[model samples]
Target: MPDKPRLERQAMCDRLAMEFQNDWIVNLGVGMPTLCSNYIDDSKEIIFHSENGVIGYGPLSQEGHEDQHLVNAGGQNVTQMPGWPLFTMQIHSL
Candidate 1:
């Protein structure tokens, strides 16, 4: 049996980030997807959307410097860009 090489978490995130173009609004999921924000290039203007209703956010916040009121869908604290907004998520009865 042959062992397959795999990309590490950060490497995978970096690869994923390269696939996105500038000015695209991207929705980041929990876990690895959330890490992609840290890899996006500075020259690109990609909007990150979180299921928690955070829109236009920046990268994940460094530990101990997290904003108490800002979090991604994964419940991890994240950094906010200019004009970022938090909205309420509503569920309607089917």
Candidate 2:
């Protein structure tokens, strides 16, 4: 996929991110929608709400710091920002 132009991906992700940034409690579906959480700028302070017993789930884990047990439904591990919250998804936006 490295051969593919990154600008297209950036543009697509950016478009969706902008649409959701102003939304409160966005109920994002899975797949590409899940990837959109990574595009929001830090200044925007967008909180990524995830299932798998987490609420404030941040970006995907950096290289070599992955926790296999702490993964989303997609089986990819995620990183948690400082002061982020965790909760049972069944109790929240299910």
| Highest-scoring model, lDDT | 1
Report lDDT per candidate.
Answer: 0.88, 0.64
* TM per candidate: 0.81, 0.64
Residues 3-86 of candidate 2 have per-residue lDDT tens digits of 975566546866888876543555344566666666767666666665545556666787799977666545568777677765
Backbone clashes in candidate 1 total 0
lDDT of 2: 0.64
- Model 2's TM-score against the true structure: 0.64
Model 2 steric clash pairs: none
Q: Scored by Cα lDDT, where does model 1 land?
A: 0.88
Number of clashes in every candidate structure? 0, 0
Off by over 4 Å in 1: 1-4, 86-94
lDDT (Cα, 0-100) at 50 in candidate 1 = 88
